[model samples]
Target: MAGAEDAGERADRFLAARFDGVSRSRIKGLIEGGAVTVDGATLSDPSLRVKAGQTFAIVVPEPEPAEPEAQDIRLAVVYEDEEVIVVDKPAGMVVHPAPGNPDRTLVNALLAHCGASLRGIGGVRRPGIVHRIDKDTSGLLVAAKSEPALTGLQRQFADHSARRSYLAVVWGVPNPLAGEIEGDIGRHPVDRQRMAIVARGGRPALTRYRTIRRVGSRASLLECRLATGRTHQIRVHLAARGHPLVGDPVYGRTRGARNAGADAAARAALAGFSRQALHAATLGFSHPITGKWLEFESPLPEDMGTLLARLELI
Candidate 1:
């Protein structure tokens, strides 16, 4: 950044001003975590002063591999072109890298399929990914091939211009046939693994939904559209509305409905759902290169299909 700063300025402030995406708190954390150094000595105080000609270094982690090793995992290719590819990713497919799962993600498969075709997307590990869905959510996803396509698709997502829809089977029928749920989402105060609809400090998230069918007294089929995508937004929003999905162990019912006095039949039906009953059913956007409107829809996965058949729409 600044080769050297005046002696009175705080290190955090100096670093924040120089980095485009860094915040003051983040800089402070980095400084306190020994990631920053002054004159080759690790400085743990954010408010420490930097004298003229004092060298500063921030040890940034090396970038992860852009393309992970490809496995022979089968992928359902829904659509593809020179500029982009739409994939019907099955449930249980990790989208990207994380702690325990560092590979075998959809990105790895795409890298193998697309090969050198995927050049610039965040390097070899992540190629062409404009956005992501959770591992358990089976659905269609679009990935970019070229930088222009990546930039254009990202803009659509940022502006909420891309149309994305989902289907879910929730624990209880929402009283209204259709509605919107809006709130700010943030990490749970107590549990790091979960998100919450908190007020004080969180990102705004919105979800809209309409009832597709009422299933008995306990559940409803729904079509949901995301106005603002957030981690676990649909599950959190629906659960907040007191209609958690039927099999959503994380956000919905737990310990089997039999313990809740449901009959064996209902409990079996509920047992059929092991993951959140959610799927990205539809996705639509304008092609980045061709400028033509494109839309793709995915039917309910086998388990959900069977459950819905039992529910009997007729």
Candidate 2:
């Protein structure tokens, strides 16, 4: 960022623009935790204003192993049997290992918790994994523990027979109060890191949503059910409808946010929510081996519950 116009810009914004495809959140993480320097001086504040002549640098750490190591991380096991395990995963936990995160994931926790029973899947480190929710979306997830369980569960998801439901606090009430949002979801054409509605070469996705509660017209609590699982499906669909989830870092920006934040306390509550105000409230599926139906429900985590109370949408 070298021009006079770039001088007062936030460091994370400027760096994100220059980094090409890297997210603002990623840049913020680098500035705050992953070492970042400006003009040969260590600078950790993501909001620091940059001088026109300042040169910025960051140390990008090498990606870790493909095989996740077993970690004794605590897990909220909702149900478990020899064939499968269901977990009430908290927010801030990645489901599986990926580029930025290598360990301490749900997979690592499962390995340590299940021991040798959770063997690798087809020589891949991700074993028994059938489906996933976003990293920051608190929810219930099921992992298969044996070969038959994995195959059967995968078949259910593929056939769109597995059931999932999410509760979201959105910026504004949807127009119809209840409806189906259908779109083809794929990677955003420009921002590769985010998913978006695309007309071509994208997979079909369907979300059925109903307004559960309303805070005047400023916001609403919505129950969203998935008919097809796609990356960021609910987020992209609701955002396209102009009612993005509260606190969703991606696909949640809109001019309507100003109206939602009209009140001082509302603004503070909205701003303070660091993760998407979304929770996987329920999940249902058939037991792979027993051919028995199983389902689980999770109440809103404390943070989301408190947010609703503050916003008066409870």
Candidate 3:
């Protein structure tokens, strides 16, 4: 079965639901790149409706290994051993090398810290990486030293067995105290650089959040968790719910506080917040080799603390 679906179902969604391990974006990329064929005819439109009993073929590109080089960069190592290394990643640090950012990445620093102990996981570029956080998001990150450790960590993340928590200052209060945001996230139909909440042709993403403190009408502090990991999951979910971050230029910008008739001290403090207020606060998982549970936490970055202090929420 080519994963038969309703006659009016979108082509991209049909293929993604039928094929295990393929992301909705990957499927859409295939369709847009003319790699999807319906009954041997190349299909270019991802939203094209499929008829019942139609067979479609989606060709996925084989990713070539990235040849990343190590640079002499300083890394704040929190913990290290034969199997794993934990580090406090500062804001503005790219987790790994990619196009436009060829050097000065966490991978380069890890290469320097671990030397040849970094085991290649399927590629030279993604050495020792089981998962990753967004650039500009500060927090604790774990890197693997051995192949077995890498495999174990990957399994934990894939099964959602790892305990991961994040802290963020959003634009408004998230109602219901504690609740879940279950939506399908997919690439925006117009903007390729952004993700959107969609009804069809997207993958299911789940984010659980609890309100920690309300930071006036401008924002609120939140502790968030991920039941399913997708690109920009937390940011997208919050923005969709009408509560963008204070300094998140990508999703929505915070209005200037001049309308609120704030005092000089408040204005000066608000100007200091320039980056998206998000941080990975805690991570826990089973030890790859020792079978012992390991957990780590990162202190709030200076920018976050400064924002809270200025707002008198600390």
Using lDDT as the measure, which candidate wins?
2
lDDT of 3 by residue, 1-314 (tens): 34344678888888898899998888987787677899999887788888887888877766634566667788888888888998888888899876445568898788777777766566553458877888878898888887788989989999999989999887656788789998999988866568889888889999999999887655689999999888888988988887776567687642432333155655565686767788999989999899899888888988999887776631
Question: lDDT at 196 for candidate 2?
Answer: 90
TM-score, every prediction: 0.76, 0.79, 0.74
Q: Give a tens-digit lDDT track for model 2, residues 121-157.
A: 7765346888888998999999998778899999999
Of the two candidates 1 and 3, the one with more favorable TM-score, higher being better, is: 1
lDDT tens string, model 1, 209-313?
Answer: 999888866668999999998999999999888887776777764433323326666666656566778999999999988889999999889988887666543
Candidate 1's TM-score: 0.76
List runs of model 3 lying over 4 Å from the truth: 1-66, 123-126, 254-267
The residue-level lDDT of candidate 1 at 227 comes to 95
Off by over 4 Å in 2: 1-63, 123-126
Candidate 1 — which residues are off by over 4 angstroms? 1-67, 122-126, 253-261, 311-314
